[model samples]
Target: MKARASPSIIRRSFILPVLLMLAFILPFMFLRVAYLVLESSTLCSSPLDCMRLRLFGGSDSSLIMKMERKVQSSRWRESIYWHLASHGVPKNLHCLHLKLAEEYAVNASARSSLPSPEYMSRLTDSSFDHVVLLTDNVLAASVVISSTVKNSGNPGKLVFHVVTDKKTYSPMHSWFAMNIVASAVVEVKGLHQYDWSHEVNIGVKEMLEIHRLIWSHKYKYMKGEDFEFLVDHERDLEFLSPRFISLLNHLRIYIPELFPDLNKIVFLDDDVVVQRDLSSLWHLDLNGKIVGAVVDSFCGDGCCPGRKYKDYFNFSDPVISADFRPDRCGWLYGMNVFDLEAWRKTNITRTYHRWLKFNLDSGLELWNPGTLPPALIAFDGLVHDIDPSWHVAGLGYRYPQVSLQTLKAAAVIHFSGPAKPWLEIGIPELRSLWTRHVNFSNKFFTKCRIEE
Candidate 1:
């Protein structure tokens, strides 16, 4: 101070402080910039409202590219350009894998590879707000995807892109435009693998597949979740009465306890339709029973060992010999209502597993392990018997001589014989019913039904 500080010393002190600050801040700035670039490049948003759009489902590189091109095209440009410019989507949307960890045979594999809540948190930290699951594997993928989509619906928007395999292209054509309006398209290579090993009987692999579908969809309800499990046999299902929707809604309110926190399902066989509102069936009480089935007297007597008169209901009825009085428990055959929780609690899977083991051990061949009489007798609880007013059960049109009065009263007619209405013979009433339900003009829906 006494010598008067040199200008060089003052300048050196200021420069040194400035350099130290820059060194500390520069790396952080660089890192932030890198993160921004990566997010912007990878994220994508819809052309329309960013709040409404979500991308999800199983997709390959080709399908993804195609979707990207579509979004970039002039048709979608106005709706999407701003989003693209802002790098809005990838930054705001989360991608979820539909594949299950257990199926892949790896420990914590789903946690490590598939997107979890934690992954979603980290992604959202950067800006992502929505989740979409893409998948070709229907059962595994859809189950997982639906769970995530529903759960994430509150915190962020959720969507599912059900990219059917190439073989199913024609079947989904009519719905394509509608699909595009809602979500992007993904073309998968093939349908999920179908397992035939656990089939109940020879040539009933299709039936076994249907059973699998029932279990897969109902598991959520059994686990006490609110979900609408629509168990359509296939896309070919045509509802004769448009009023079916109202019927389902009525069932939800009036018979709430029947299904227990799940959407009451309508299990339609291919050959039936409703001419009037089905609300009556939905409101019908099942007491505490878990399932409802149409009573059929013609169930193959020889098929059920328990159906024989020797297995009489009252073993001690001295006046009624075992050979004279059979346990007429009224079998729940064809078109049935399943109480998801009740069925789960009964351990149907374990029962089915035990049945399979018994059959294998005894070298017995049984077709349709779900043959109602046996299942009803074997199951722990009672099943409610619905009037034939809802279900007309028989060989489809083969019994043309049978009364249509029965058919008219029936909410559902089961074509349970060799000749199907689609074959143009069995039940003329059924053919008429099918025609009434389906619009022949829609080639896509028609084709899907035939293929299925």
Candidate 2:
């Protein structure tokens, strides 16, 4: 107290403490600034609600968790399936495995077996009564074409325009060329030969080709407990099939564009078998409508057009909600009679494009799976209801529950849902109907392991 400290010493002491405090505070301040800058730069790729929750939001977001779990589940299931299939634990390899398309082309016997694809170009002339079948499933195509022609009372009148993608063109052509259906003229053409679908249209095909690719956060329309429910649920069992079967399955949508010169044609799906004359379908009057299709199923009163197509789309968007009614009855797509002249008059293609584009831009808010919903919308007012007996659906999903009487009565039976008659999953008893059409005696059949 008696001796006062020097000014330099006092100043030195104060400076030391201040410097120490800054040293401790500066690092923390820098760390906080860095964190804020990093956070502000974070951007979400998709506008989906899940993206927002995952990016800037909370871990408690049930939607995010559900998506994660669902993805994990699919991966898990796929791995288990692969493991079993690799070990030959699977009873039917058809469902579990797929041979490379080139493999079919490689077999000498298979290549030698098909009928000439030379008649493929004749579709443009409209001189013949054509039954158009567009597919890449050579096996299924063979069965369907053979069955259709075999069941027809007049096989010579039947002309099958089997259109496929470029990669499949040669093999498909070969298959048909070798296994010539008696009196039925079969034509095979690649997608490249058809100049109808534009570049943008090709993109649609590509998108479908890659749909199973990282579903990820692209589709995030759900929230809360509902998200959890969808984790285990496959909305439509057919949703997964399109990824592998994209090229063939979606070709049905562009039938009018594919065959520009044809006025009227009968379109058959690859999964279908004809037990009666489909020529009768061509004879039925469409009443000026562009499409003739059978109703999917009867409703409470057993009326036609019972299935509501609108249910497949997301009506939450103002664009979709304003344009479509969720209660409208939907039609099926297996065997359709397309009136090309009438179709050209309508904006079915344009409508299909517009809706398809909107759905693409809107993150596929239209249909959850497959190409049917777009066709349903595109052919909305243009569908003519044929007799229900002409096409029998639900054979795939519920074969046992199907009335044997009804199945027998059907002119055409569609393995519409998923359990295709050719797959191991198909009902053995029901499969005999489709198997009868396969040429097991053909060398291609034995070489390709296309077992009966």
Candidate 3:
């Protein structure tokens, strides 16, 4: 070489190469550290092991082995997913959801016959007893109707007044149209069918805002925190489905406004699966009471406070606690007999509006921000407790603990919580109770590819 390369030149060349390598390698090294940190805390195991213990009739080791194999095959996949995706509603499965989009598209319009607009006026025209259901979930409503009719000894003696939101009117009407309940009359109407311009309900927007804001920060409104109380489910907000949080949940309050002619009607939640004949419910006299409901399994009043209604309101305020026994127990919502004719006479709806106005004006966090607290205040002494056998509450919230015996004995099972049978997180053992009612062959479920 021309008197060998100078030492400075050689050192400079080496340093340049080193810097280039560091630039390329540093990001990879950082990523590796992050991956290690995250993997340690990740929930890598599947529910298969739990399912095995719950129902598989197989060995735990075999389940573990199956899990190990699954993890191994998807070893590289985890790295991609861990960096990119969420836990529930896996992206891989979402690819199959095209059918849902297709089914909900414009093609899915009403195919069945609906009653005349004046059907409500001719209350005595139908031979069947009437049951009213209000919800936005077309699928769940379909299940309820199908199951109710299937169990009803007299299908011809059943009339269903299905009320839904504007967007859902098509699907709701469509399903009932294609799948007629034999001789039973199925009526589908949108929430807009009712007039809300009345003076009593004109402030609905403000009332909803008040309920919405305070109810969200329930703990802050609870005054203070207790360690023991906080740790032991006292602060447990409980999971509520988005569907249950809407104005629709509060729609029960407007039954008289929605159906003017019906004297009494059985109200069923969309999540309820009717097993026994609900026609008998129409026969049960509400005894002139405005509402007939089962005891709220989880809420109560202040003076007798345990849980339930008391927990939902800020009883600390004299406005809420005064004469409104925080200790007075409340009732459940799922299956109820609403005497609209009777409710129309009382100031119950007016009282409901008054409280809603109070809660809004003072920002008092009055009753829990939901439909129930207002009902509790409005129907304080008007509710009549029916046989607990008619309704079973809390299936969706407290899953595994719910015994098969209770489910089997109940006339109606209500999944009030977020873990509905149709969702991915639904309890396997309990989902079958709902799925059995779903006609898998139905074009909607088949087109949407909804499987057990």
Candidate 4:
């Protein structure tokens, strides 16, 4: 221990420790260098700022702030993209329509798909369980018919009245004609087939212009605080989407006039799939209430947070505030059981027309776009709260929040939100439930590249 070590031995001993230290420090140094290189593009706005950031590592919250901005921008872009997609028909479905139209034009059997006179008579007989569906989609109509008939206890009693626009008439009729539902009677009628007054047409046209203006320039009407609600407002606007402003969407108000012989009917949106026997809905006593529907209050989840009257109507308007309570809860419309007999006694249609004119005259300030707002006003006291299990809605936007138990127990599941099941943007899990009812193996579907 007293002996002095040689210079070479001492140097070797020091070198080993130094090498270990360098090895440990190198990784951290490399990581820092990589971070700087990766973030070079956004290191700082100016040369001085970059130098200061590198030297002091101060005011570096800018990086995190920039990241946050990017995230927000991404979300906004996503919302806009979804809105655009929802408003248009999917390419595959458009292809299906074209192929079906071609088939209808040439194939004799395609034109003869309507049920015989004996079964066709049952449409107006009203003894059968009548379900009304208004849509221009051929695939959707097929799914609705297929699912309802498949789930019905008495399939023979189920009759579907499918209404479509003029453009979709040929394809819609051909589809039902070629692929007939054995148990159910499907009657496809076009808008042109219906006989209504020119006065009614003018009223709808005026409403259209008002709605178009409101939707086309939605942000123009927003107040300072309202911008905070832009996220929810965008979602609400889907209900009144431009895609749904067609004449068919307005036809719900005139249900009594449309089907005079039917005492009652189950109105189904094309976006819904029936999971249980709907015959029971026909038997439910509405107790003088014009419509039997599931209340949004019972949702108990995000799928359908209870909406109030104020959520739909403009309470700032004197007429709206005087007549409607801001806190009054709203019911859903997708799977409603309407007592047409009761509706006929009331001036509901006239009231609807009056409000439509009033809203147009007031410069579209009364409510948001879409048919639901006017409907909520028109059917104010006439909604009968049916069992929540009968109709489970919000499949389009909030499918994840809905539990398996609830969905399994539901008689009808509605994709009330913008993401309709047939669309590419539709959630995969929920889409499967709707697609299960679709006949993917059908020749027409295969020919048109329509797949699961």
Q: Rate the local accuracy (lDDT) of all candidates.
A: 0.37, 0.66, 0.67, 0.79
RMSD of 3: 14.6
Candidate 4 runs further than 4 Å off: 17-67, 217-240, 300-306, 398-400
Residue range with the least summed lDDT across 10 consecutive positions in model 3: 298-307
TM-score per prediction, in order, is 0.38, 0.68, 0.70, 0.88
Quote the lDDT for 431 in model 1. Answer: 59
Error of 2 at 157 (Å): 0.7
Per-residue CA lDDT of model 4 for 1-452, tens digit only, reads: 69999999999999999999999999998887666655544434444544556657666787546555655655656776786678887888999999988988999988884766778789888788999998988998888889988988889888888989889999999999888788788898888887877887776667666557656544455322233333555565465456656667767887786787899999998888989988888989998899998875445644343367777788999999999888776788788999999899998877776787788788778887677788887887888888888888888883346788889999888887778898888988889999999888999889878898
TM-score of 3: 0.70
Query: How many Å off is the CA of 21 in candidate 3?
Result: 48
Q: What tens-digit string does per-residue lDDT give for candidate 3 at 291-386?
A: 888864422233121135566777888877776766566688878988777888999988987877777677655665467777788898898878
| By lDDT: ranked, best first | 4, 3, 2, 1
In model 1, the runs with Cα more than 4 Å from the true position are 1-263, 296-332, 365-374, 377-380, 395-397, 443-452
Tell me the tens digit of each residue's lDDT in model 2 across 102-175: 54557565455233456545545565678888776778888888888777888877888888888677667666
Residue 384 accuracy (lDDT) in model 1: 75
Each model's Cα RMSD:
29.8, 17.2, 14.6, 3.4
* Model 3 lDDT at residue 230: 27
